[model samples]
Target: MNVSINIKWPLIILLMLPFTLAIGCLIQIKHFAPEPLILKKDEIFTLPSGTNYAGLEKLLRRQHLAKKTCWLPWLIKLEPKLAEVKAGTYRLQPGMTVRDLLNLLVSGKEAQFSIQFIEGERLKEWLTVLSRAPYMKHDLHDVTPQTLGVKLGDPADSILEGEFYPDTYLYTATTSDSAILKRARQRMKLMLLKIWEGRAEGLPYETPQELLIMASIVEKETAIKEERARVASVFINRLRAGMKLQTDPTVIYGISEDYHNSITRRDLMTPTPYNTYIINGLPPTPIAMPGQASLKAAAHPEESEYLYFVADGRGGHVFSTNLASHNQAVRKYRQGHDIRGNNE
Candidate 1:
């Protein structure tokens, strides 16, 4: 039996038309069934934190921001990266494809407002600026230095003050208040770890944690880079001799708003643990986020017996070993230049 060129091939092909159309219809439904209303640049999706994929899809579809929220899971099942979308306030531009939108979410390229923490400014000013920033999810009313320690699973008094080193930070439109605090804390922890790993021998601080605490005090005492080591040394000597640290920053740190600003001679007498004149040891916690230099100072103090330090009207302080020499140095160098006597 020989096979002939199939004269029934045309009929077989014709019979398959209905099946082909059915498959086409099924695909159309599977891929793009519900068309979404177009979105413009002015259109905004105020996405909240903790939004799961299913919750987000329904919301987007309802607002006409998505073509079919139902298909999101299936698409992610094909490409699992889609489910890893970050939560942020997303502004939609008109005519953006679903794929493009998903790519933005996966990349976490959300819109942000910038907040800069400047050097020399105290924590009060820093907190004020941060509280007014946009997209913050935390309550500023509850963001005192004392409160931060509590959030970190410590007692209210255990939190460090004024020590979050000044630096630039990036934040999303609706980042929580605690999240921002967490970032500053994380920075402090990182700097301490790095400095501790490379510390100098013969320093007084035994552990990285103690070093950080002392550095926090030194950081608040002086912003001058060259003076940091000497300032650190004074505290070290005080610690060795069983004397009060008597540092101004610590007293200022313990005081409330009225007490922190415009510190007076009497403020030092306040019966607070942070008032180093009264407290014999380190404060309950780190005073602030100490910078690398301050941390280094804590680790590598100057080899001097200087028991006295006074601001020299410049950005630095003058150090001396004895009262007569310190007074003489003060007369020669700091005369007529508005020097403030740091009560030791």
Candidate 2:
């Protein structure tokens, strides 16, 4: 044993070179390959708050993403600048690589969800939509609208109906219904203030709240975008002339809880705080949430002498400047006249 043969260190190093290079290449391939957490579009993956590299490796191994546990170490050592991965629910595409997944995780961009509040929807409808929205934490189901309004910093006498802006709201998985409502409420206040500042001169509205009430009525009256300004003008003219609004939407809203199918003559004659046919001024509160377009129309109505309008037997309306023309238009509508061709 003492008389050992001389062995060259270079030869030993050369013999080991190929194996080391092979391992290095395999690690590189695995690092650049598709991610271990890649899932289908409908599938979700969650990483707990304190998940570390070791935990991630085990999870990948369980998912059969790698043949061995050596690649993660190499990847991590190579990219030391990558921050610690955040903890949250994530969705990964099929083609995402390990590098891409790591980048997404470290950037702390969690999954985003959307909830929509449609224009002209009632507060009841909004609550239903919120309760049914996916991933929304519904804690306000038992809360009354008045209570919610107070929590939103509205006046003690304020009604919650139509106070929130209608639009698509973005939130995280844990966002509460109250949080979304708060944001929408603030947005609505801002929008109302801006529109109020740009309102047309000599308008009949004495306050922003009155303008909102009018806007809500306009929203419910017509689905046609071109008719909004004209509809607003008709209401404004009626207000200026001290005439009853006589709008069907307000009557329907007054009895919405018991409304079944059609409006009866008796219903129009019935008096309520919201019955424009019987009330001298705007309703006590808004009937439904109005979109920005309706709000704008209410703020700056088309200047016209039109005091009355009737459905033109189409998806629009016919405007008239006097009761006689309005009565004639009503007769035409009753007689199934095709007034669409005559309306501009």
Candidate 3:
């Protein structure tokens, strides 16, 4: 025998009511979940030091990154340490969420700005470039080189030129120009000390400063890496042989603010502190910034009898031990010949 029972629709509905309510609540929570912000472009967000949760909310509001302004204040209630944010410029991504942005700020991952001080650049040119770097804080306007040295804690009474190390320097947006220069200056000092300590014995250079001056000349002489030591050797040989350096770059440096073209015979005859033709030794100051290769070459120059070199039309140079051979190489290069001089 089969038995039949009748169930009311209202009873079934009543039983499903609690589950229905629970599903609706879940749907609401999912709707309010954190999501990527809608930004057309990435921006730099700055959270100053000691910013509290409320301050962060205001900043986020201005940046259009905040979805729910109350979320952070409540979040700080849960994780109190999140309230302590570091001060820095941060690269806020286009799709970054409030959570992601907050995490980055709390993590102290600041945006980095870089400035490259190229080798062989004059100190004045370097300063001009540094002053124009975007987002870099500057205080060097109208500051004399002497005052700059004092600000950088240098006790030397002489002017600081070619004293800054040539390298790519990383800094924060708020980093002062003076601070970057100070680090470069310190780096150069350390490098000079280290190189001087291990310099070749019997080098004619009486001091590290002289080595720097010669290194600057070598840096300006050639851009080819393999030629640095060779060029430095020629200068050293000339110094030892009691010959005037007679380098064109040194002569040009002597002309200073007046130099703008090929060296003239009159310029060679002119006497200045930096004129190697008139002065039988290294210039009183470095003519340009020397890189590590040049510095190392100056400190540990190759042993060679080469006393002269000229541009070989190509990037490399033609070295010669005698005036006749040097003149011949210069003529060959001027004629655009690919002749590798016998001195090589």
Candidate 4:
């Protein structure tokens, strides 16, 4: 009887050992699952492509992100979907648990980065900004305005300046720079067409391109929202009266690399397709990228007799109906200002 009891007790102990180990493993998993990842602040974690569960386990262990990640293999086995981790950059925040990290890796929602194209800036500036942006695929090598315009499917004669809408664009890792520019161009085309269709009547502009050119001028003239229409009116009134636009921004655009934060008398007198001081009508192309407000203002200018404007020595401009008033305003606010002899 004693021998049978002893044999039965050893068999029972052996049977319970497996269950005990399983329960202990379950307890361990539960304890570690909710523990916070070893991060003081938000961190950027990148998982390379083709990495599987084993690779992920090795990475977590090597990075020391968790105190006890030896059970990760078992965890992944229990939840087979966790093994399917997508490759991309991820922003891991503090207080996130191991389970949360696993869920994020499988969610495939990679971190988003942004690039801003500012209004009144040229296409070259936008390209520079795009080139410096992180994680972008730089496909535009030796890019020029003409080449870029062709890539955007624009007309052979189309100028790329002011073609792209100035706004913040969001992109994921490995996104091409050209892709962002394409989106901006598409947005600009749609918005410009919409605004052109609803433009005010009796305007001097013959086409949507003319309106865009005027909008770019207005964008460079004044940044104040309230003054945009007034600025646009000055140019439109000039176009109607057959007077020279005589705008400084157009001359600067003509000067291009030669402009050194200040325009010289020679620059104003120089003859270029974009030089409005010497040119009869609107410049051949837009000077800079115009925002929505400038586009709207150029489409619908305020009803006024103003034909000239000069810097008001403030963040605004002084509009005038005639040369005398404009010269007087320029003399008062901007003494020795570079005003055109015939007009302002």
Candidate 5:
């Protein structure tokens, strides 16, 4: 009986603990917790494109991000105006909660944007693309290779045309042309070095830079993707045989004062440093930003004595050892396709 009178404060405390925690959870759930996690795109994303909320949720469900979005629908219902959340480009962090992400969606917030540049694009084309970079307010069209912080020798020198590497580059829209151009040059150097490391031996090229020149030719020759290696081989064959590559693209490149797309035979015959038809060896530089595939093709050309090639016009090419076979292939493949051969 005396023992029964003893105080059970520990048990009483234990019983009240659940209630206290429950109340604390309720208070947190109601109004005491953080509003939302601040997602800084400038700091988080390295690439230009990525996921939205639902997409993020789906991805998170697969463990890309942390969980806690199970009650997302209910949480969104907590703030009906939040349900009107506008999807926007953001730099979301890892472990963002449903409620936190909801607030970010409801609030328009951006510090930067992701931008991409594909291979085979012209440098002039990049001006338009950079002009539209998010958070960037200034016009980059006027900025050239010299003004962009990247030192390419002379002031009027614009050797960066086809030198910009192909890849996903990270930059805030507020990033300067100088920074961008420097980054681009670095990327190009990195890419060239990588291609050089894997270059095939016994090729006619003296250096990787020369290989880039050949790659540009391969890129411009046939749009047929599978023909790159062979096309590169044909150019290499010409270089090795002391024969002029006679590539029209190089001629077109020469007279392209304003970056014209096509050229006439007269343009090919016209004397210029870039016209392979009128000169010998590779062009002074690359005509376009050759992709990795094109670079690889240039590094490792398909072995052949055939110094001639003509477009099949069906996303392919016909290789030939001489003009007769090349002409036959042209008639069968090219039909009315011009640029077969000058001697023919």
Candidate 6:
């Protein structure tokens, strides 16, 4: 009987050994799961592509985010979902626990970044903004106006100015520059189509492109919300009367990179496709990006006989129906500057 009891006791001890170790590991995991990590502030963590659970564990240990412990491996083994971590940039907040971090990694919600394309800015300026943005992939190294226009199904010689909408766009890390530009372009197209369909009747514009050109001019003319429609009316009246749309913004755009801060007489007289002083109608292309308000104003201009406008020396403009009145207003505000009837 004593020998039999001794053999039974040994068997019982062997059976209980794994259970005891498992209980100890469970206690360690519970303790580590809720404890705050050793982070003082927000931290940006990047998990490289093709990284697995074991690799992440090693990285956590190396970064001192987690203590070197054997129980972590046991926790991972118990929760198989923890092994599935998505590769992307993540922002880890303070007081986050191991469980929270694991959930975030497996959820695949990467940190988002934003880039803004502003109104009245040129495409070159927008490209510069994209190039300086953080975490963006510079895929536009060989991009030009001609190549980009062709890629967007426009003619190879098509001008890409004012084709993209000016707005803030959000994207994940490593988003290509071309991707953002394409989205902006699509948005602009949709918005332009919508506005063109709802355009007011009897406007001088023959095509949506011509309306876009006028909108770009209005956007550059006055930032005042009330003045946009009035400004559009002036250009439309000029187009109807066969008079020159003598705007300074077009002259500046014609001068291109060589334009100084102020427009000179030489720039006004120089013959270029964009120089409204020389051109009889709208410029061949838009000078800058136009926002929704300007586009809408171009589509639906105010009913007015104003043929000219000059800066009021304030933030607004003085509109006139005749060149004599326009010259008088220009002389009143401009004082000693050129006696040009249009806003310079």
Against the true structure, candidate 4 has what lDDT?
0.89
RMSD of each: 8.6, 4.7, 6.3, 4.0, 10.9, 4.4
| lDDT tens readout by residue for model 4, 281-313 | 999999999999999999999999998888886
For candidate 5, lDDT tens digit of each residue in 1-344? Answer: 65655557677888899999977655555542243333333234221244444554554455333335443444444546656555444556644644655566567564465567777776666766777676554645576533543333435554766677767777654466546755787877788889888888888777778988888888878666778898888888888889998888777777877446656666767898987887878888888888878988998888878889877666677799998998898787744455455436
Q: What's the TM-score of each model vs. the native?
A: 0.62, 0.83, 0.83, 0.92, 0.64, 0.88
Residue by residue across 270-326, what tens digits does model 6's lDDT show? 999999888789899999999999999999999999999999877899999998999
In order, candidate lDDTs are: 0.73, 0.82, 0.83, 0.89, 0.68, 0.88
Query: What lDDT tens digits, residue by residue, belong to model 3 across residues 37-57?
Result: 657787777787777778887
Candidate number with greatest lDDT: 4
Q: Is candidate 3 or candidate 4 better by TM-score?
A: 4
Per residue, candidate 1 scores C-alpha lDDT tens digits across 7-59 of 56777888998999878755654565234336756555566678777776787
Number of the candidate with higher lDDT, 3 or 6 = 6
Compared with the true structure, model 4 gives a TM-score of 0.92
Model 2 C-alpha lDDT per residue in residues 1-344, reported as the tens digit of each score: 43342356667788999999988877675655444544444444566789887787776667654445546756666666543888876666665667767787788787788889999989888888888877667888666655666656667767789889999999876788989998998999999999999999999888899999999999999989999999999999999999989898889888987777889999988888888888897888999999999999999999999999998877899999999999999998976754444554
TM-score of 6: 0.88
TM-score head-to-head 3 vs 5, winner: 3
Which is better, 1 or 6, measured by lDDT? 6
Ten-residue region with minimum lDDT total, candidate 6: 335-344
- Best-to-worst order by lDDT is 4, 6, 3, 2, 1, 5
